[model samples]
Structures are given as C-alpha cells and as structure tokens.
Target: EIESIANHYGWQIIEQEIDKDHIHILIRYSPKWSILEIVRLLKQLTTYRMWQKHEVYLCRHFWKERTFWSDGYFSCSIGNVSKEIIQKYIQEQGR
Candidate 1:
C-alpha cells in the first residue's frame, strides 16, 4: 500500500526490509524531490493504508506525537556513491 502511493508519485523503492518494530526503505527519485517530503508522504499515506488493515500503533503513542516516524529520519546522498557502497553504509549502521 505504501508502495502504491509512492509509485503513484513516481518514487521508486530500491530496497526494503522490516525489523521488529520499524521498517526501512531505500528509495530513489529525481533531484526534484526532498527526503523530508518523501518521508512525510510515506508516513501519512502508510498510516491511511494501515487503518484499512485494522492496524494502528505509534499513531497514539505519547512520544510518537503526530509523526508515525521519529521527528528525524536517516537519509544520505546517492550522488557519486555506488549502490554497493550505499548498501554497505546502511548495513553497517546496524539497523
């Protein structure tokens, strides 16, 4: 469902994985998009989709506030960086 909204807006997901309590998605798009905007779109649209599945979590957490994700998200530049290098960097973060 998240993919639907993203793809609709022309955002491409390069990789994705789910951990116990969170999700990690590697995305790519043209230079016109901003990481913050993409993250906002993901959380908002995904929250909408989650309701359809009768699932709700951090939406109500005191600390989650209005963001399904934290106030900040991890992002990096793909410019001049190989996919292998990017993958290794994200992997080494131990996420």
Candidate 2:
C-alpha cells in the first residue's frame, strides 16, 4: 500500500519492511522531491489509509489526537555503503 502511494507520486521504493513499532523503507527519489516533501507524502498517505482501516484499534492504543506515526523521523542520505548493503541491512532488521 505504501509502495502504491509512493509510485503514484513518482517515488521509487527500493525495499521496505514493517516492524511492530516502525517501518523501514528505502526509496530513490528525484531531486525535484525534497526530503521533507517525500516524508510528508509518505506519512500523510499511509496514516490516512491506516486510520481509515483501523481507526478504533489505533485510537485505543494511541489515544492522542488520532496520530499513527511519530511527529519526528530519522533519515539520511545513502552514500559510502552500497544500496545493496543497505537493502540487506533493512531485510535483516527484526531478526
């Protein structure tokens, strides 16, 4: 579902994983899209869809103004390490 939304907006998802508390997504986007823009779109679309599907359940757990993801996120430019290495690292998460 996140892949679909990202593709709709011209972002390429290289790899992804959803864990119990968070998600790991490796994306390649064009320069026209800033980090802030990409993050906003991803969070907004995914949160809206998730809330639509699990409003009651999410509200039960969150119980704070109906938010799914955290207001803050951690992101960094991919360099030095190869993309394959990063993909492998993400795949190894939660193991």
Best-fitting candidate, measured by TM-score? 2
Candidate 1 lDDT trough over 10 residues, lowest sum: 58-67
Give the Å shift of residue 71 in candidate 1.
3.1
Q: Write the per-residue lDDT of candidate 1 for residues 7-72, one digit (tens) a residue.
A: 898988776766666666778787798888888888888766665554355445633344444556
For all candidates, what are the clash counts?
0, 0
**Candidate 2 ranges beyond 4 A from true positions:** none
Instruction: Tell me how candidate 1 scores on lDDT.
Output: 0.70
lDDT of each: 0.70, 0.87
Minimal lDDT window, size 10, model 2: 64-73
Which pairs in model 2 have colliding backbones? none
TM-score of model 2 relative to the true fold? Answer: 0.89
